[model samples]
Structure formats: C-alpha cells, structure tokens
Target chain A: MVITPQRNIVSRTWGTSVGKKSVIAVTGIVFLLYVIAHMIGNLKVFFGIETFDAYSQHLREIGEAIFGYEGVLWGIRAVLVGSVVLHMWAAFSLWYQAKKARPIGYQHRQRWEGSYAARTMRWGGVIIALFVIWHILDLTTGTVNPLGGDESAYLKLVASFDRWYVALFYILAVVALGLHIRHGLWSAIQTFGANSALKQNALKTFAFVVAAVITIGFAIVPLSVMTGLVR
Target chain B: MKLTLRIWRQASPEAKGKMQKYTLDDVEPDMSFLEMLDVLNEKLVLDDKDPVSFDHDCREGICGSCGMVINGNAHGPQKFTTTCQLHMRHFNDGDTIDIEPWRAKAFPVVKDLVVDRSAFDEIIKSGGYISVNTGSAPEAHAIPVDKVSADDAFDAATCIGCGACVAACPNGSSMLFTAAKVTHLGLLPQGQPERATRAINMLATQDELDFGGCTNVGACHEVCPKGIPLASIAQLNHDVLGATLTGARSD
Candidate 1:
C-alpha cells in the first residue's frame, strides 16, 4: 500500500523491452523446474504400472499433512499457469518490437551467427505451447485420453503412446522442447546470474547438457510404450 | 587485383537507393579496403561521375568513424576488423563484393553508406556523465580496482560507439552498444552514485528510440570490431533487473 509509487515504477519497468525480458527469464526458470520434476516422475513407469500410479497419486498428496488434500498440486498448477501467461506475454511483446525495429530489408543479408537452437526459439516455443495443451488434456484431465476418464497418469501415457502416431507426435514435441531449452536456459542465465566472462563456456555446456538430458528423459517413456517395452 | 563492387547509391536521407556496379582495375593486395574505394572514387571523379560515398576518418580502426556492410557482415567480412583496416588481400582477383549502409530504424541511412547514429548518443545522454574529483587527479592508488573488474571495465570502455553491433543484429537491436556504455561506467567507482538511475534511464531511452530487443543471438558480438563480448550485454541485463526489483527510478 505504501509502495504505490514504487509499484508504478515497477509496472512501467515491465513495460520496457528490457524489463519484459526479465519477466520471460524468471518465468523460464519456473517451466524448467516443472518439466524437470515431471520428467523424473515419468521415470517411475519403468518400475511397472503400480509404481507409476503410486507416484502419480503421490504428487497430489505432497505436503498434504500440513496443507490438506491436493493443496500443493493446486499451488504448483497456479504458479505454472501464471508463469506460462507472463512468459507468452513478454515473448510476444519482444517479438513485435523486434519486427518493427527493422522495416527495411537488406538486399545482401546472410546468416552470420547463432546456433540452430537460437534461431528456432520462437517457433519452437509455439510448438511446445501447443503440445502442452494436448499433453494436459490427455494425461492430466484424461478427457481425450484413449483410456478415458479416471485413468492414472501411467495408463494414459501407455494408451496414448500405444498408437504409433501419438508416440511420433510426442517425440516431435519433446525435441522442440529440447531445442528451446538449449538456448533459453543459457539466455536465462545471462539475464539473472551473469557474473563474469570467465564462466561462459562452462555455463553454456551446462545448458546444453541439461537440455539433452531432459529431452531424452521425457522421450524414453513414449518410446518404451510405442515399442511394447512398457505394455 | 581487380574487383567488381555492387554499392548502394542513395542521394539523400529521404531518397530511394539502388545498388550500382563499379569496377576497380589496379586494386593492390596491400591496399586497405577503404583505399581500394579511394582508387575507384578517383576514377569516378575524373570521369565527371558521382563517387561512392562512405564514412571514414582514421584509416586505422580505433576511431570508430568508419563502418559499412561488405557482403552482409558489418565492418566487412573479417572478424575483429574494421572496414578501414580490412585489406584487399583477403579477396580473390576479379571477385564481386557488395557494399551497403548500416540498416536499422534508429540508424537511418544518411547517404550511400553512412547511417545517422545519433540514437547511440541519446542512450549515452541518459546514462549521464559520471561526476569525478576533477580539481586535481586523486592519489594514484586511492581508488583501488580489482584486476578482473578493471580489465572488464577497460573492455567495455573500448566500445567506440560504432553502430556495427546494431547493423549486424538480426533485429537491429542496439543492446550491445548500450550495454558497452553501461558496463564501461558502471564497473568503475566513479559510476556508483548514479548506477541505479543510469541502468533504468538508459534502457528507457533505448526503448523510446524504437531499437529492437536483443534475443541473445550473439550476432552483434560476432561482428564487433572491438570484440566486446556478450558478457557486457548480460551485465546490462543484470543491472536493469536489480534496478527494477529495488524500485529504482531516474527521477
């Protein structure tokens, strides 16, 4: 209440391109945490359907001793939803600003820098967003899931991926997620944790490794189901 | 060496421009890229034709007065080399080269190869000048700076306000140029008092000028003549984040 003047300044700061990027960077960390935990949880299916089902049920029951049923899961969902909204808002604003900055085209333009991952970040983000909606519907809500309502997360994953096309689509989206993380994670570091130039190489390598590990971690589940390994 | 040059020719700031082809017969490998242009200009002037105009002052690279896109890369094809310092030796005989101006909304083409880069100056003005004890130089060792910070400060200070970074960026963002100035001063003790405001105001001015937002593409650093690293831009982001969360304001 006393900081209304400061609030105006903070809001105005977010209105700037630099401040908008800050929002993207912070929200990016949120997604990173969520996906990593989700990937690790997905690994429980390897121990068989019963173990995977227990893990899925356990996620909702986390911190229930203090906060009551599904409290922690709801809190996580709220933060994740908030993060996705802010991330897209900032990303779109920056995208528009970037487009408007160069109305005139160079007759002799050439690709001089950036990784393949960096260049495809915008498109990859879009792919991942679409996949997230499909993913939530299939597994979380079980609405369009082949196993349909009340199925556990493991059975939904198995039923969906049993079809070759679903497995293929899931793999495609996971690859896109990997590419997005390969560049986005390092970029987020540059925004929030930038300290010195000496650590750049190490940081970049770390980003790439994390991205690759997470992609493989998520992809294996669908691959196992498609190949009848998890059936 | 002989070469074919496709150069953009614009008469004025508001005029439409087109690429005109020219040939240079006696271009020596030892000659600087700008000197080769000089030879071409000499023949054009003698022929009563309008010569190709480009910006250059110090034939040496440090002045930052000269810049042009040669075959798409800002400051020519070489890494860490300014256009004036780029020599003809790198090219093959009878090679074709394309020359153009720094293209960006903030840095509009002033003529053939010169873009008005006053937007950079506006960003600098927002940073404001650092106040120092000016009556006499303070004791030599009075303000001790760590080796790493001092080295980085010097690295950031080396940005010559050249628009090469802006020209090279895919989005035409001036983040590198603005970051250079911000880090150059912010790293020093003299720059402490205004640090918060400097970060906020400079970025605000940058947005006001309609320059693009940096996407961390690393194109600017790739073509930077000074080799101003991407770390500077990261530092700029860091400062702005700190400023925003702490409720810092220019006023």
Candidate 2:
C-alpha cells in the first residue's frame, strides 16, 4: 500500500491511542493468569496450617541468596509488584481518557446495554487494588494485621479469618477479583485479536469458569479458617 | 406527531456550534428520521433561515453518510439500522430530541451535524487495502474458504465505517469500527498477503487519531448501524498482536 506523509502523521498519532489498548490487554492477561495461579496456591490453606505455612515458606525461599539470604521469593514479589503497578497505571490512564471523552451528560439518559462483567470492571478494579494493598500490608509486610499479633504466620492467618469483617473483606475482594478477571480475561484475548466468534464465545465462557474457580478457591481458604476446619 | 428537536448548527468548520431548538408538527410516524429533519430544513429554508447542514448520499443506509446523536444514541434507538433508516415513530408526540454531530477529536465538526470523518479514511489508507494481483477477474469459487469463516468475515465486512462506534464509545474508542475492517479483510484469502503489516499499520493509524481504548463497553456493538459485533475488535487486537510479534514486514 502507498503511504503518504499526511497519512503517516495521522497514523502515527491516532495509532498510538488504539495501540495503548494492546498493551493494556496484554498486561491484563498476565495479571489474570497470575490470579488463577495464586488462587490455586491459596487452596493449600485447606490442607491445614502445616501445608499452607510450608507452601508459603517455600515460596519465600526461591531467587538469589544474598549473604545466605534466599532472595528468590523477593524477586518474584518484585516482578509481581511491577506487573500490578503497570496494570493499574494502564487501567487508570484508559479510565481517565474515557472519562474525558464523554459528554458532560446525555440529553436523555442512556441505558447501559453491556454485560455484568463489563459494567463492573471499574468498580471491581478499584476494590481489587485496595484489597491487594491491604493483603500485602496484612500478610507480606506484617504491618497492620491483628493475627500477626505474635508474628506466627499460620496463627496470624487463622486469627485474621476469625474476625467476621476480615473474612468478609477477603471474600468480597475475591468476588470483585472474580468479576475483574472474568471480563479482563476475554477482553485481553480480544485485544490480542482473537477474531473467530466461536473462539471469542469460547474464551468468554472459559473466562467465566476461571472467575468461578478464583472466587470459590480463594473463598475456601477464609471459609475453612472461619469455620475451624483448618484447625 | 409533534416533536421538539435541539439540532446542532454551525456555519463553518471553525464556527462554534450549539443545539438550536425547532418544533416540527404533524410529522408522519412512518417518515425516516432524516426525512423528518429534511422537512424541518424545508421550514427553515422557507423562513429564510439557513438549514441545518448534514451529509447524506444513498438514503438506503449503505453509504453510512448520515449519523447523529439522537437522544444520546448514534443512529437513534434502532439496532442494525442507519440514521436514514430510523423511523420517526420511535419518538412520541411532544418528545424533546437532542441531536448532535458524532463527537470525536479525530472527527472534527465540519459544519452542524456533518463532521469530517476523513480520519477513518486516513486510518484505512494507512493499511486497510489488499495488494491483490492486477489481472483478469479470478473465479470466485477458486478460493476454497470454509463456509463458517466466510460467513464471519462477511459479518465483519458489513461495518459501514460510520463513526457511530466511536461516537457512542465513552472513550471515543474506534476499536470496533477499526477491528471490523481489519478482521473483514484479514479473515479472507485475498487479505493474507498484507495481513500482518495491515494489522500493524492500521492500528498505528487508529491510535494516532486520538481514539480511546476499548474497555469492552459493548456500546459500539449496541449502537452500530450494521450490528457489528464486538468480537471483531477482539479479532483486530489478536491480529495486531500477532503482526507485532511476528515482525511481519511488507515490502
């Protein structure tokens, strides 16, 4: 195809806007896959504190051992932190841009015709972001957790879930994460350019299943702890 | 039926525009929306007032020239129907309708409801076409395409390049529109030669126009005159990514 200078300028600028979605979609898929993996990992809690704590400790021991310190877990955490920041930044930027593009208000109220997954993405994203911060502070950093009262990771987890609010927050966050993942998964595939309707619908259905697994799998941990099944 | 319309009016590309109210009485319910506007324009012309400027050629809806925000929807409330095909019966007597041009920074208002949608043309120009051979027409049946694939491609090809998807998008995302075209040509046998580069360059053009990202709002599909599915957007994304990764360079 023949390319002109004016066309070049137009593509260079306009293409950048559409191009950002590609990055967002790619990174979102990475985060969602990580979520699925994390949910499966969290399922260790049901096997009892020994298995869960051992698994957590094992994760903590995996990168570079600095002066006899195994920095593997820290390295993984760093990578995860970077992914989280990138995902959130991309999401917020798109959100801000979308907000600016809309008219102040519709002359007549526009009814939303989108699916539940797409509709709640923004809200679900916000809740998940907040939950991540709380989760890291409570478990990873041991900063504000009630159960970390004695620095016993297993006991801390058990005690934390004992609280109705803490348990509820975790459950609620997982649900929100579920919604975010369900939409994000297929959307990421769309961004990646999956064109076949059969493939698209399959991805959508697969995303729903993943979301269900994450929601139920993560919930199992807290629910088990709350009900004394883990004890 | 009688209805009040707040139509956007602008004298030139540089002129600031706003919604100006006009009342049309005894409007036939069977009249197309644009026809109703035409009736209103005749009244304005008779009154020695400048008629509202818009674009239209083929009134049958294939041309995609007519598009306006009707009560906050592009191409009005009907699904898979263009503005010219929209009937006035959708509105009730005494209804106050707000009509405006398709809003997008890339699609600047040329005059009144007629915005310069040339940005789409530019995007397509960037890489939308196939580099087919120049020779006698090939037998249509020569390309042994799977019926399912052919059907899907045809559906994507139905997109008329009306800026409705962008206009209806909260982010002004043109993903659906762009994707429809890219997927339409990309899925076909004829499009294979330029497929990789086409996806890349076309996407580059899409972003350059200051269009917003697709958050999968599905509004584009909802407002699409041809009912272009959101799946095409996904297809576009997939093709772009594949193109970008494979380093498919077109000579």
Query: Per-residue alpha-carbon lDDT of model 2 for A69-118, expressed as tens digits?
Result: 44776565677778777667767777776665554434554554477778
Weakest ten-residue segment in model 1 chain A by summed lDDT: A1-10
Candidate 1 lDDT over residue span A91-205, tens digit each: 9889888888888878897558588898888878998999999988988888889888797777788888988898899999999999999999999888773745788889889
lDDT of 2 at A175: 85
Model 1 stretches with alpha carbons more than 4 Å out: A1-9, A63-69
Give Cα distance to truth, residue B195, candidate 1, Å.
Answer: 1.6
* Clashing pairs counted in every model: 0, 20
Give candidate 1's whole-model lDDT: 0.86
Worst 10 residues of 2 chain B by lDDT: B242-251
lDDT of 1 at A147: 88
Those runs of model 2 whose alpha carbons end farther than 4 Å from true positions after fitting are: A1-22, A61-70, A92-106, A119-123, A147-150, A220-231, B132-146
By DockQ, the best candidate is 1
Best candidate according to lDDT: 1
> Second chain TM-score per prediction?
0.97, 0.97
